[model samples]
Target: MIVSKRIAAVAAAVGLAVTGLAGTAAAAPAASTDLRLIAFNDFHGNLQPPAGSSGRVVLSNGTTVDAGGAAYLATHIAQLRGQVKNSLVLSGGDNIGASPLTSALFHDEPTIDFLNQVGVSASVIGNHELDEGYQELLRMQFGGCHPTDGCQFEKPFRGAKFPFVASNITFDNGLPAALPVTIKFVDNVPVAIIGVTLHDLPSVVTPEAIKGLKFGDEVQALNKTSRLLDLAGIRTQVVLMHQGDSTEGGGPDDCRTLPGPARDIATRASASIDVFLTGHSHQQYNCVVTDPAGNPRPLIQGASFGRLLSVVDLKINKRTGDVDRSATVAHNEVVTRTVTPDPTVQALVDKAVTLSGPIANRQVGTITADLTRTASPAGETPLGDVIADAQLAGTQGNQAVIAMTNPGGIRTDLVYATSPAGEGNGVVTYGEAFAVQPFSNIMQTITLTGAQLKNTLEQQWQASGTKFLQISSSLHYSWSQSATQGNRVSNITVNGTPVDPAGAYRVSVNNFLAAGGDGFAELKNGTNLAGGPVDLDAFTAYLTAHPNLAPPASDRVTVLP
Candidate 1:
């Protein structure tokens, strides 16, 4: 189901490569005029085989196929590089952390080791890399002091294989050196790749994880850095960006239509960038986008967690030393599940699976009913509501009148549990729930006026697809999208009747959204009356206390006319 749109231009006379079909292999010219590049993003540490069905990915042509896994990806990469004299492999960030039990349990050490074996040239540091403390990120990148926590059976942590790239993030005083902005050459091509995580990390991530960091403007940072790289004579450029768009499809191979942050920024960027490898939204796409400069630039992103591989083949003109005007080629290889797991990657995973045998098999807790995360009728989700409720309950305050949770914070979908069961052989395990909410987020309580609360609701539509506020208890309002943006919320109520617009309210939420992250402007404006308690700890406590807790059906928060 992998979709591709090939734009082959020979001196302004353009011919579209046949859609839904692979392009015929171009004959290799002697002393080849073309150089090649391969890129991927948002891997999120899915080292084992994917969750469900396994089958070959079929191209539009009737011929059958096989794809994916680090080894298969390695094989494809090796084959592609063999065809061209110069080649580069790069990532769009989030290559590690917020992953499955196989990788997450060990804090992504195995994932890093695998990347080392794969010869990944460079990578952008995705937001999840900062899911643990920033110091944890340093530990993953460089060596660190350690005492064996329950992981005594496993091998000691080995640090990163390659340096992580982050041009816009800077540490406060007393912090270590920041990651380099650009990588110079792979086979002496002078290729420059700018790495940028989302600018809203402080609000999008658990506050404890990103407390001492600052996320700068991605567009501004890239623009200045691209200028610097251009001035230094680096012609070939790519942005390994973690921001992504949404998509509609049943499985991995479905084509994407709505572009996310990558599209908006790519469309407005300078002419220096030639390609964009994006992630974060877990969508699949292969298409060419034009920057503000009006030049067509190529881009690709696979579905999350090794579900697919986006193989972008670029032919750099030998004479111009840039993207070949005449022979540019691009397509994606969906990593179907059915293929025999690549022996090498499988071997590596098998080794990790053996080492993690005890933890992987242990059970944590169970749900009495389905804990689905799909958006609700009011654009808020019950999963989000449950998460917010846990955060509120975790905070020991008497006057916690309200709460909020970001949709992005809920990382997995939970099915209803038939009964509470024992460890390793029960309904759900500690490993499973931890995988669902892996980030170390802390619950936060902030005070805001009912007026500010109204503004927060209004901001949801200021931009489409923003996470609507999922309330912990009863907070009522109505909106009509047919009307104005922020003015949509009406019939404001807290317990039952109506909430006074000027009255003060104490609200609980994660640290991420409270800091104006993800474009929720009102959250940034709320008064930090007080903040305390780890959100993750609260979530763990809730699960431990209510092993058979059913999702509440009383939908208190709503969007109305």
Candidate 2:
């Protein structure tokens, strides 16, 4: 243990070795320099116990355990905090937006309230933070009534006490919108944490949400921020990054096969960064990657929905103010149900549930079976088909004959069994539908030539190697794994008519797709655009119109050998 503690003296916040002129042995390390960093990410306003698979964690032992809830998280956090005197709790963002019914109903006030109550120092701005747009995000930071919705809570809604930092986001004028670094003192030691979202924010977020804001290069931003912090004499630096990598077929805590933007960033960024707390991929990993200078840096992501918590022990050297990287150790801990739920957090949750219950619990429609998000090899999911159809229906007034949606937009599986929201088996509710398509994206109809539609589909496999789009019943096509990328999509038809290069057709898509979000730049080529209802409204209307919605056969897209 002494040896482990001795290594905490990394280049940042680390005290130099106090050796005599005669080369005396090093003295005992100071206990006051130890700083406990408790971190989590991608919370997404899951104030209640997350439903179904969202609330479960699979341990390295291969056993699945139920986890998460604000109450239990509060208990776990307080207990962990109690064990250490000098500590700072942090998050990697997505703390709000894409939220469940309980928090989203009031515009995620409860999420901010929870964070403030728990003493979260700061968080980076995630893609979801812009879900409602920049002005809305500002409102979240500095409280007021919704421009349209007014205040939903009983009392006036005061905003977050913690600061939001996004090192890479800047105004069109090149001025930073958020502070690049936040400094906190623990035992008179200043620890600087730099925060930034992924570099590819424009690709994943709606164009409307990021209208005039520009996301700067992440590596450049971090390097500049670290240098500034170093100049300011705050060398014990960490990065709260809202981007991550996934290890295929690896356990939650496995890092042996790491490959993703997070790893790539660690490989490119300056070695002065001691650790990275990442999110967005929603995959859990606790691994150390070598930085550009060959120094080891810890990169961790606690899985989404409060299911996991990352606890890190960092010791700084008093005199040098550098991290004892040698003494740093981190691990992802499961927020197991064995821990007692904090009554205070539960009370807050109970009040939120009480206010949100009526609308969330009321049944909207019935389903014959689960409309799972699991896609076939051809990229067709039952839930996706239903969502596509809903968008088509919503845009029919605008002459939309077919619709498509991004697979990543679908958040969860629509189960046939009774849900945690207390609805009956096979019954769907407003809250469930909202949870399925929570981004509040408006449906849009646009005119696209047959060739343009073809280009959009092919573009999916071009830039990023394929993020398949879910198609409406009016559209049908087949692709083969053996064929070349451009030649893969074939037998394309709309309403049983073969696509003609010169023919124009009305296409239905969410505003995100309309703006070429997700790398489908061809979408931006569509002309004669017309706006339609919000996506959730369209989906709820579909459920209301078809009282007994059945899962589409999952046969829309064919995968051939």
Candidate 3:
């Protein structure tokens, strides 16, 4: 039965007078069993502790503490699991991809090993999982050496022990891409776990990576699978969703004004869903929203990079085989490094770090100061400017006059301080540079008319959100805050020359942007496409070419009030 029908039946039974039943013997209350769920999202293969702001978690008291690292996360999970007799470890997607050098260097096999050792029951497929394409994702699941780079690790690549579930992603033939639902028998009571990613996955990932896959609506796919679980007599349902929302800077468990896709989906989702474990926006919140049947359920997200864990404890009524909504409790816990690190997991981290040390520690260049991704008021960043310059220089052989790079690709800042590897101040290592641009996207130069370039600039203000492209120093443009979306950009120039609408210009961008990823649809219309070196190579080469490199100014794009 659907949730609405079940709710209506209960409503109709309320306030009924039963004089004869009062005289009869009273029945015993239904027995309930406790089931604990330990969940995290967007680990992103940080086997070692992440550095800088990404490694910290804010508390409700407005204080922050250092957190995260695979071994530390393992210790926290073990401690949480021990609190209940029946517990399950779950991930809300992005277990790998966009990882640090140690994990990404070995094709994220070490991270999978960590997840396997820690006993993750299942996970959702995040957008970054499709970074190397679907076939590679399949390889990550079923076990195999990379088709090209065979067996980079000591042993043959073993696949993830946990299943990657996705109800919405389907093949061209209308078959599901992964397991839609996983059933876990907790103390003889069946609990169903369903997973789905954001519906707008195509806009974020490279088009070629998901060539034959179709991403369906998250609510529809979730509801459909939920109904099936209900009919199968499994009423205790949980959703591990890769799409989430944000809140004002709050503590791990604070849920002040939840606003985003996750909240919207929670309200419309089936009441049978006992709890939602969400990610994607990388924000932390613990919220309760009323479902379609007017029942409040927990919707929680732990901060990304293993910095926090979202814990949901459910009381399953053994008689009805359903979760006791009134008894459900959820909160986010910080994965602090105070606990003793799990020795086994730590060993895996040690091995990977040792094997990757040679290439990871190689000095790439020097920086005079930090080149951060923190955007200026006009949306450009010092690191983004440097990346754009690098892309242009790498493609100059193709006569590329201007270059633009997306802010999303600039993952981390290049800090001038000494690193954990003990690299001296102002020194930049190959590993650090790789972490900033881990996608290994190839550079592409294309021909676009000046008019099309303007249209591309106009696309910065998309319906989803504004994504300001970072351009090389040679290109300059100003945008208006009051002007409408398509007409906001003006004063476009290249080397101080006014842009001619009909004139053809050679522009450079990464393959992801060149294929119109991030809603930059105008980039897809370019002609005379020419491919160049990989983005990481371009970045490192540029850094090497310049000594004592200072961060470029973020004043390229003028923002008109």
> Model 1 segments beyond 4 Å from truth?
1-36, 49-87, 145-156, 170-188, 200-202, 206-216, 247-260, 354-360, 368-370, 396-401, 416-426, 447-449, 502-506, 514-516, 519-533, 544-554
Q: List model 3 lDDT by residue over 43-105, tens digit each.
A: 999998887667889898988899999999999999998888778899999888999999999
Off by over 4 Å in 3: 1-30, 60-63, 256-258
lDDT of 1 by residue, 437-547 (tens): 766555677888988888887777745475676777656667675677566778778878587788888888767777676677677777755775766667767777777
Choose the strongest candidate by lDDT.
3
In candidate 3, where is summed lDDT lowest over 10 consecutive residues?
15-24
TM-score of each: 0.78, 0.91, 0.92
RMSD of each: 8.4, 6.0, 6.9
- Compared with the true structure, all predictions reach lDDT values of 0.65, 0.82, 0.87
Clashes of each: 11, 19, 0
Better of 1 and 3 by TM-score: 3
Model 3, residue 223: what's the lDDT? 89
| Ten contiguous residues minimizing lDDT sum, candidate 1 | 10-19
